[model samples]
Target chain A: MTDHLVEGVLAGDRRAIARTISLIEDNGAEAQATLAALHPHTGRAHIVGVTGPPGSGKSSLVNALALYFRRGATGERGEGGSPKTVGIIAVDPTSPFSGGAILGDRIRMRDLAGDPGIFIRSMASRGSLGGLAWATADAVKVLDAAGFELIFIETVGAGQAEVDIARTAHTTVVVEVPGLGDDVQAIKAGILEIADIFAVNKADHEGADHAVMALRMMLDLDLGGTATVLHHGRLMEVVRTVTGGEEPPSQGPLPPARPSAWRPPIFKTIATRHEGVVDLATAILAHRAYLEQSGQLVQRERERAAAELETIIQQESLRRVLACAQGEKLAALIDRIVRREIDPYTASQHLLGG
Target chain B: MTDKKIRVLIAKPGLDGHDRGAKVIARALRDAGMEVVYTGIRQTPEMIVEAALQEDVDVVGLSILSGAHMALFPRIMDLMRQHGLDDVLVVAGGIIPDEDVPALQAMGVKGVFGPGTSTDTIVRFIREHLS
Candidate 1:
C-alpha cells in the first residue's frame, strides 16, 4: 500500500497526493516512511509564501497570483515542456478555545476550483502558533514530490512563526492593507525582515499610497538607498507613537539582515480587481532567477534544512523523554515540581537521567 | 500514538445563504475538541464529498436551510457511497421537517437537527456514533 501510494504520488495522482498529505498531518511512522520515499523527488518546486493579517486580502491576492502563475506563458519544463502545476496551502486559525475554525481561505479562492493543474488545501493552525501548523512543511514536501512546479503557502495569521514560513519558501511576499496603523510598523519590525517582496493589497482603497510609502520608507532605511536619516528618524518617531510610544521588542537577529545584494520590491495591488497581480508574479519569478544566479538558492536550502532538522530533533527528543517517563513516573515528577520540592529546571535534568 | 483527534466537516450545500447554524455547530464541535472544517455556503454534494475524502473527516454534518434536503441529502448519500465513504457518519441540521427526518435517515443520514436542537445533542450523537 505504501509503495502504491508513493508511486501514485510520483505520478501526480490527486487522490494519492491528498492522502499523502493527510498521512503527513497525522505525523506517524507511515508519514515518516512516506516522506522518506518522497524526499528525493522534492527540491524542484519553488515555494512562495504569502502572509498578512486577517482580512488584509491575503487570500484574494493568493487566488489572483495562483491564477496568474497557472495561466502564465509556458516556460521551460522538467523535461518535455509539460505545463506547470500550482499547489496552495492556506493556513487558517483553529480556535484553541473551541477547537473549531472556519477554514474559509477556500472561499476566496473559488475561482481556481475545478482546474486539474491546480491544487489548494486549507490547513487549520491546530493550536500551533506562528501562523502555521507543525505539519505544513511536510505537506509542502508532498506537493513538491507530486510534481508541482510552484507552491504557494499562505500563512494563517501574522506572527514570527507565520513569517517563518518565508524561511522555507524561495520567495516570501508580505501583504499589507491600507490604514493598518502600527500594524505595519509591527510587521516592519518583525516579519518584514524576511520579505523578499512586498504587496500592498487593496490598492484601490484610500490609504494605499500611504501604505506603500511607509513600506518604501522602511526598505530605504534598511537597504541603504537614497533614504535620508533625518526623514527616517521622523518616521521612527511616528512608529513609536503608533506603537504606544515605544519601539517593539527587537526580534534578536535573523536572515535577510545581512544586506543581501537583492532588495525587496513593493507592488501596489487591488487583489479583488486582479490589478498588479501579473507584476507580482513576474517579480516572484525574477527573484527566483536572482536566487539561482547568486547561488543563494543553495544557501536558502541549507538554512531550511537546518531549521527542519532542528525541529525534528527537538520533537523527537521531547517524545522520547515523555515516553520514558509515562504513567506514574511522569506524575511523580510533576507532583514534586508542583509541591515545590524541586525547580522545573532541576526536574528536567532528572527526567533526562542527567 | 493512541490519540487521534476526531475530524468533522460541516458543509452548507445547495445555494443556502444561511450559514449561521452551520457556523454555530462547527464552533460547538470544536469546543468539544473536534477538528471541524466548515466548507462555506453553496457547496454542492460533489464538493462536500470531495472535501470529506480530502480532509479524511470521520464525520460530516450538512446544514441546509433552503428546503432542498430531499433532493440534496440523497445525492450526497449516493455520492458518499460511490466514494467508499461507508464508514463516515452523516448528519443533518437546519429547518428540516419531521417527515423528512426518516427519509433522510433511511438514506444513511444518522441524525437530524431541527430548530431548538442543542449543539451538545449533535456533538454527543457524533461521539456515540463514530465511537
Candidate 2:
C-alpha cells in the first residue's frame, strides 16, 4: 500500500496525494511508512509563504499571485518562466473556545477553481500555536512529490506566531493593509524580520501610501544596524555598520552576524483587482533566484530541517513521558496537584524521573 | 496515531448566495466533535472535489439553494469519482425537492435533508452513516 501510494503520488495522482496527506494528518504508522517510501521524491518545489495581520488581504494576494504563477508554467520549467503546477495551503485559525474554524480563504481563491493544474487546501491550525497545522510540512512534501513546481503556504495572519512561516517557506511575503489604525505597530519586532518581500495589499484603499511609507521606514531601519540573526536561541538584531564594503567592518568588536545581501522589496497591490500582482510574482521569482545564487537555499533548508528535528524530539519525548505515567500514579499526581499537595513542576519532574 | 475527530467538508456549489443553512450545518458538525471545513459561499463542483481530496474528508455535504441540484450534484459526483473519491460519503442539504432526492441518491449521495429539517437530524444521519 505504501509503495502504491508512493507511486501514485510521484505520478501526480490526486487521490493518492490526498490519501497520503490524510494518512500523515492522522499520524498513523502508515503515514510514517508512506513518508519514508516517498522520501526520495521530496524537495523540488519552491515553497513560498504568505502571511499578514487579519484583514490584510493576504488570501486575495495569494489568489491573484497563484493565477499569475499558473499562467506562467505549462507543467515544467521554462527558461525563466512560470511554474506548471501550483498548490495552495491556507492555514486558518481554530477557535480556542470552540475548536471550530471558518476557513474562508477559499472564498477569495475561487478564481483558480476548475483548473487541473492547481490544487488548494484549507487547513485548520488544530491548536498548533505557530499559525500552521502540525501536518502542514508533511502535506507540502506530498505536493512536492506530486510535482508541483510552486507551493504557497498561507498562514493564519495572527501576529507573532506567523513568523513560523519563515522556517517553512523558501521565500516569505509579508502583507499589510492600509486604514487599520495601528498599521505600523502590527508589523513590529519579530514579525518584521521574517519578510523576504512585502505586499501592501488593498493598495487602492485611502491610506495605502502611508502604509507603504511605514513599511519602507521599517525596512530601512532594519537595513541600517537592525540586522537579523539567530543568536542565543532567539532572533536578535545586531547593530553594525558596513564600513569598507558589503560586509560589516571588522574594526571594532565583531558584530554577531553579517548583514543579508537581499533587502526585502515592497510592492503595492490591489489583489482584488489583480493590479500589481504581476510585480509581486516577479519579485517572488527574483527572490528565488537570489536565494539560489547566494547559496541561501541550502542554508534555509538546513535551518528548517533542524527546527523540524527539534520539534519531533520535543513532542516524542513528551508523548513517551506521558505514556509512561498513564495510570494510577499519573492520576494520583494530578489529583495531588489539584489538592495543592504538589506543584506542576514537581509533578512533571516526578513523572519524568519515574 | 488514530485521528479521533471526523473531518467533514461543507461546501456550497454553483452561484448560491444563500449560505445560512451551510453555516448552521457547519456549526452543528463542529459542536458534535467534528472538524468541519466550511468553504464559504460560491463554490464550483471542481473546487468542492479538490477541497475534499486535499482535506481527506470522510464526508462532503453540499448546500445548494439556487435550484441547480440536477446540474450540480451529478457533476460533483462525477468529479469525485474522477478524483478517486468513490468511498467518500456525500450528503446534501438545502432547498432540494423530494423528487430530486431519489436522483441524488441514485448518483451515490448517501442522504439528503430538506428545509425545516432539524440540525440534530443532519448530525445524527452523518454520525450513524460514518459509524
Candidate 3:
C-alpha cells in the first residue's frame, strides 16, 4: 500500500496526492511512513508564503498570483509558452471554543478550481499559533513531491508575532492595506524582517500612496537611505529611535555592518481588479533570482532544516519525559517548582537525567 | 476530542439571496466539532462538487430555499458521481417540502430537513448516516 501510494504521489495522481495530505493532517502512524518515502522527492517546488492581517486581501491576492502563474499577466501565457503547475494551501483559525473551523479561503479562489494545472487546499490552524497549521510543512512536502513547480501557503489572518511563514516559505510576500496605521501595519519588526516583497493591496482605496510612502520611508531607514524621518510631523533622530533611544551597539575592532543588497520592493495592488499583480508577480520572480544568485537559497534551506530539527528535538524530549513521568510524578515536579524548591531548569535537568 | 475531524461542506446553490438557514446549520455543525466549509451564497453544482473533491468531506449538506431541489439535485448528484464521490453522504436542508423528500432520497440525498427542524436532528442524522 505504501509503495503504491508513493508511486501514485510521485506520478502526481490527484486522488493519491489528496489522500496523502489528509493523512498528514490526521498525523497517523501511516502518515510518517508515507512521508518518509516521499521526503527524498521533495524540495523542487518553490514555496511562497502570503500573509497579512484580516481583510488585507490576502486570499484575493493569492488567487491573482496563482492565476498569473498558471495563465499570465495579460490573461494569456506570457513569455514561457507552457504554464506552471501551482499549489495553494490557505489557512484560517480554528474556533477555540468548539475546536472547529470554517475554511472559507476557497470562496475567494473560486476561479482556480477545476483547473488541471492548480490544486487548492484549505487548512485550519488547529491549536498551532504561528500563522499556519501544524501539518502545513508536511502538506507542502506532499505537494512538492507531487511535482508542483510553485506552491503558495497563505497564512491565517496574521498579527505581529505570526511570522512563522518565513521559516516555511522561500519567498514571503507581506500584504498590507492603507490606513491600517501611520507607519503601515506591516512595519513591525517581525513583519518587516520576514518580507521578501511588500504588496499594498487595495491600491485604489484611499491612503494607498501614503501607505506606500510610509513603507518606503521605513525601508529607506533600514537601507540607510535617510537619516531623518517625519515622525508624527516631527523631524526625529532616526538612528537613535531605531536603537530604542540608546547608543548603537558597537563591535570593538570589527568591520561595520553592511546592509543586505536585496530590498523588498513595495507594489501597489487592487487584488480584486487584478491591478498591479503583474508587477508583484515580477517582483516575486526577481526575489527568487536574487536568492539564487546570492547563494541565500542554500543558506535558507540550512536554516529551515536546523529549525525543524531543533523543534522536533524539543517536542520529542518533552513527549518522552511526559510519557514516563505523567500524572502525580509530573505534578509533584511542577508543585516543587512552583514552591521554589526547584527551578524549572534544574527540574528539566533532573527529568533528563532520570 | 477525536484527532480525525469530520469535515463537512455546507453550500447554498441557488438564487436564494437569504442564507440564514445555511449559516445556522454551518454554525451548528462547527460547534459539533466538524470542520465546516461554508461557501457563501450562490454556488453552482460544479463548484460544490469540486470543493467536496478537494476537501474530502465526509458529508455535503446542500441548503436550497429557492425550491429548486428537483431541478438542482439531479445535476449535483450526477456531478458527484462523475467526480467519483461515491462515499460522500449527501443531505439537504432549508425550506424543503414533505412531498419532495422521496424523490430527493431516491436521488441519493439521505436526509431532507425542512423548516423548524432542530439543528440537533440534522447533526444526529449526519453522525448516524456517515459510514
Kindly indicate the candidate among 2 and 3 with the higher lDDT: 3
lDDT of model 1, residue A18: 76
Winning candidate number (lDDT): 3
- Interface Cα RMSD in Å, per prediction: 2.4, 2.1, 2.1
For residue A138, give model 1's deviation from the true position in Å: 0.6
- Please tell me how candidate 2 rates in CAPRI terms: medium
For DockQ, the strongest prediction is 2
A238-332 per-residue lDDT for model 1 (tens digits) = 11111111122233322333322465777899898889986788888888887787677887788788878998999889999998888897899
DockQ values of all predictions: 0.40, 0.56, 0.55
Error of model 1, residue A157, in angstroms? 1.2
Most accurate candidate by TM-score: 3
Off by over 4 Å in 1: A72-83, A182-188, A225-260, A325-347, A351-353
DockQ of 3: 0.55
Candidate 3: stretches off by over 4 Å: A77-80, A184-187, A225-260, A338-341
Q: Candidate 3 residues A1-354, lDDT tens each? A: 778878988998877787788788887778889999998999899999999989999999999999988888777754456788999999999999998888889889977867878888888889999999989998999999999999999999986889889889999998989888867554556666677788999998899999878776666556443544432123433331221111232322312343324556788999998998888888887778866876778877887888888987998788888898889978999999999999999998887888
